[model samples]
Target: MVKSPVPVFLFITAEAVALLANSAFLVVFPWLVLSHTGDAGKTSLMTALVTIPTAVATLLGGRVIDRIGRKPSSVLAGLGCAVAAAGFGVVSGLGALNIGTLIALGMLAQAFLPPSTTARDALMDAIASVGGISLERLAGIRQVVFSLTYAIGPALAGLLLTAISPIAAFWIIAGAWTFAALLTTGLPSGTSRKVSEAAITPSGSVWKLLRSRRAVWMAVVIGFGASVITQPITSVLLPAHFRDLHQPQLYGVSVSAFGVGAILGALLYAAVGAKAGVKLYVGGVLVTTAGIVAFALLPSFWILALGLALGGLGSGLLAPMLLVAVTRNTADNERGQALGVYNAASLGASPIGLGLLSLLLQRHPDLHAGAFAVLGVWALAAVYALTRPSVIVSTPGQQQAADTAAV
Candidate 1:
């Protein structure tokens, strides 16, 4: 067994740093666009530009992970993001930054995100298998780490934006990505020897493989649903709402609250090691939708925070459970591709939702709450439709046994 702690530690550390950088960039980028253009529509368009390329990259990310090995792929992705961020910062510092420039840089930076994430997931799986760690536990730990970064990153960005220039903030992000890239060098290389040759070979089109497995399709659908509801709210709506309220500080608080709740939810799942059943997953989605609705409709600041927390917790719970489901349901060699499709679906939904929300708000800027209400209901309906007994079906006995033991 590969018993060294070096790979796991380095992987987690690098991921945490990268996530922090990305989260901060997310906060800073939109704020910059909105502040500069004074237009939410432009900000939303910028977000879409970033997301679309990331989705495309994610669709091909699995094959890259499988072919090049996780370590090298992760390193290269991290380096790519760093370079893009640094370039953006330099351009901004030179006073050449515009919406088009921002969009181009955003696309460049985000294009690397999906592949880095894909490689990290694949690396985690390899670590779990070789180190005899349970995938569920590892996933739980990952969620918690992510939550912590999410908690810290936005708050830090808000502070930085308040005290520093946008160019400086971008430079900080560039540095963080550089740090993360450096950390990746310590990770072990090569594919898992335990993976079967049959599992590695392409059996036909990836779409066909996905269609053959109910769980895979279910994961993709649910991921897409979750993304549609959550991404637009955080990315476009909440920012616009807070800006209108003239309390941009509250944006950071709301984001931190969500992250805190996510941490709690992930920790709970980690402690309990619950089965990733359809019922549990759907329940989380329902709870998330309700929380988002509350966030949209509630008048009080405290209430909005509560809603954000609840929604975030629900999202947190759903993520790991879905990951566990997909991981368990897939062949070891096909795992990267399956997860790639899942990631791609989830990321792809973000641009569509953001675009729709942008158009809606552009047309009816006062209908923010109403729009969120509609999205919440839509998400609920999608989850209900997707999680029907006919859709999810039961897990195989052997897989169920393995899941139980892992938990």
Candidate 2:
């Protein structure tokens, strides 16, 4: 119904490659720290160093993206990642790698990620507008692409580490980011010129814009809850559960099933989510809570896998739906900032969730199920509180009109 969609596809391809590289680095970096230093504390410290800077950068990077334009910002961010990755590879190859170097490289690599993500989202919005596609549909496709990349990234990192070395893995990550940078160069320079212009004017205060949009703030709150519930489950509880069961294989299977279900969920959303309403979003939250409860309580391995898959499917739907809500509620000039804040809220929740879960586990060492049950209930309450009818009410016609006006 619109013009060529080649640029949109290319943008997604580039973003997918970048995400894969980052995911692989996430796998390899901690492994390198553990293998080299043999200290869990050092690994945790290095992770914290990276994470804190990344969160701060994400909170601030929207202004940079809005000022410089999406294409150039994305290209520069990709190049920055490539440089950091290559630097780490060289350091490792020379046998001079240390915790300090790792921390520096991690900070450098991670600081660019938020800007890259912001640029990618802005570019996708532009492309979707040109292609006459709804933002919800485009978001679904993006989620599927991301899920596929995430599914492959860790496996690829494991293979490279087994066959080659960490240095080689770092080099591969660098190459992937380099490829992403090159792809960004092909995008039109003026894809979102109007938004950029608005961003450059004196009226583009992110705080003011955020204050005006109640829906955007609500979306951020919802995203934070989703992150708090889901992140610790995968990073902490699931592994511990599998270890207690004495079947490490179940962990891999459960994770794989989750990824597959996430892909399927995204595809289903792409097919029929455009016409879906607030009930769909509420259903996703409920399903995710139910799956978490099942995963915590169910003793059978097959049932556990099903629970993980159901949770993943529901989790997959929440992200795109929230993105749609935020984009629909905000102005084009403020979209980048809104996304940045939303992302910050989500990323910032992980550590808070992890810390709280850790404290609970310390107090009751054998109460993993109870901890998860509490998280599930917390998730249910958070979603219900944030996604009320007053907060997210919107008809398809209103959304379509907003999209058309944005273009």
Candidate 3:
């Protein structure tokens, strides 16, 4: 039997909407904290407080996805996100939003986000299998969509925050997730065909196979590093920078610039990624690291934008590069587990970094000093990626990434 294209497209659309909503919500939430309290330390602390649940969820949510089917998991995740977001919006609308309530509601809303993301990835894999679609091609397309969300999502949130109240802006997040849940219900539903074997639970042989693949192992670290550094940029520092300026819209524009740069980087990966060898990935990381560093050094408007754009470009390349590296190295049976570890490393690392940066920035009175420190850390991470080994020799297309980079 032939599968219809509708489900695949519908799945993509649902993910796009859901992601856009989540991105907008994240931007709005931090700003809300900063604006209301007029304190950068509290904002950083609150952001870290909210991030804790998401990191924890990413670590442990695989079993839930396994038990309940990715499709149902996605649907439930959307609903949970919507309900949590709505609760926050309701409280804010009532003029009762406070730091304690914000953290509680933010944590509630954030906890669902990782599961929602994981379910979507698993769902897309299942969809590709059923539809005879290319997972690589689909993943590339989704990466573009993801980048677009950051672009429009923050800008839109900024607009709403400017024109309407944050309460109204936040309500839109709830509505978008609700819409995403409804859209997910239309897609095909089934449990993951692959088993759930997390690193901790993996047998000795599986663990050995994973570690033996040094390139992919290091690739996960690179991704984890990328995420860890980027979080402070998005969550703590940038917001503080804008809070000082007293301009919410520029904050959105700055983040949207990162998103736009990410779009280009993702597109670059799509164009030349199949053959993107170790050298090209390292080059991109170094170049993007400079951009982030520039962002920290120069706080002026246009220069700041340029720095973030460069940082954004690096994000685009690093994320997909990690995905391709993992998919190329692992077998079908091992892919699920490897991906779980990758997600944990990539997404889970952020909370720790965010929390640490929050502490550093909170203690330091000057945001610029703290910001430079964060960028310096990211620069070190980029240097670390340069030192790592390439993918396994047996893996296909290792030369292609290199060849393309050379071109």
Candidate 4:
């Protein structure tokens, strides 16, 4: 049941575009805001306005994705991005860019994105079923694609910002997503599986899953634990530390190294499937913990890059394994909701983890290195929970069976 190349291409291209749209915001919006407002706080506020809405709206978006079907949701999301990009571009071109307008449009564009992501994943799951693709493999591929896009997107944004006006970056972003919409428009929309049935009723059953008491706990643990590392890698800890070491501009290079490592790790994990997944999960956590500790201790730019790369590898392994577990456990009808929940949990944990770490750093400068020590402990705890008897651990045979079924 090999999947047709066309569907695979469409799926991957769609994901790339969707990701580029999201990633480009981090680039385009700040530049747009800066160009207009000329204030860093205004730029930060614009970012918050966009991201907060998306995070809060994920569950609702999931329901929408389920109702409308994945393809349509994807198109709508892509179009939303395209339109937002175009609007920002036009406003910038007109010299009428305003903080109020950026905040409003940013939030609106992001509102459509999370549902689109859940739908895209739901669609991918359905396609995998037809193509006989392994969920593990698909998950791994998705991680690789995400990392690659993250690596490339910022550079492209930088180039657009430099070559054109900062506002022009929005146009480039819009153009990139327009291409993504074109690729995604071709996705097969056959009603193969419905994912809404997995939604937990408001009768407190949602808490059962949220409490990390079921098969879904695997996702919760990874989501939360991954947040601890992701924040440090993306912001204050890693980037600032690099700059302190005189390689401030190499921020992208260091992050790209990690992304590249993540791609490699995902590829390796996919090749091995579930047989290696548990071991990889445990090992990756250990590697990441070690990497964090190393980065804190060494503080050299090269050493920090190496440690971050290792940490990224660990993160890459943890995420897809968690995704496979969540997808496999949920019924098809509820799959979209289940994934949406997992994604929400994972994303929601970031602010909490980073906030706590920030507070700790502010209070106890001596605990600079020790902050990451807590993350290491969190990673270890996550791995331990993953090995618990209730986790419905996958075997190689089960992996192959699911893989075969996917096609």
Top candidate on lDDT is 2
Model 2 lDDT tens row, 1-407: 34767777777889889999989999988887888889999887887778777787887777676777778878888999899999987887788898788888888989887788877876777777766677778989999988999889888889888987787788999999999989889866656443545455243466665555666666777778778866677777778888888988888888888888788778877777777666667667777776777777745888878888888888787778777777777655666677888888888888888888888787788755555655665666555644564455475356446445644
For model 4, the stretches where C-alpha displacement exceeds 4 angstroms are 1-3, 90-96, 191-205, 209-213, 247-253, 274-277, 299-303, 367-370, 373-380, 386-392, 395-407
How well is each residue in 142-222 modelled by candidate 4, as lDDT tens digits?
889988888888787777777887666677778877888788777665623434434433333544544433556556666
Q: Of 1 and 2, which scores higher on TM-score? A: 2
Window of ten residues with lowest summed lDDT in model 3: 191-200
Instruction: Please report how far candidate 1 places residue 293 from its true position, in Å.
Output: 5.3
* Superior by lDDT: candidate 2 or candidate 3: 2
Q: Per-model C-alpha lDDT, please?
A: 0.75, 0.77, 0.74, 0.69
Estimate TM-scores for all models. 0.78, 0.89, 0.73, 0.86
Number of the candidate with higher lDDT, 1 or 2: 2
Q: Considering lDDT, which of the candidate structures 2 and 4 is the better prediction for this target?
A: 2
Where's the lowest-lDDT run of ten residues in candidate 2? 194-203
Give a tens-digit lDDT track for model 3, residues 1-407.
56667777888899899989998888888988898899999898898778878766764565566555567878898999999888877886688888888998899888888888877776655676666665555666678888888667777888888887777777888999999999989876542443444523343354464566655676677777778877778877888888888886898788878888888887877677656556557767876887877887856889899988888887777776667666666554555446666787887777778778878867886888777877777777777777653642225465345434644
For all the candidates, what are their Cα RMSDs to the real structure? 5.1, 3.6, 6.0, 4.5
Clashes of each: 0, 0, 5, 11
Give candidate 1 regions above 4 Å deviation. Answer: 27-51, 89-104, 161-171, 190-204, 235-255, 274-283, 289-304, 358-407
Candidate 1 per-residue lDDT, tens place, 1-407, comes to 55766666777788899999989988988887888899999887777667668877887878766666677878889889888888877887789988888888889888898988887877776776655666767778888998888878888899999998777788889899889988987765543323444556473467776766666677777777777767777766677778878999998788778878888878866665445455655666677776777777745678888988888888787777778767767766677788898988887776677667777777777755545655665666565645553334345455545444644
Q: How do the candidates rank by lDDT, highest first?
A: 2, 1, 3, 4
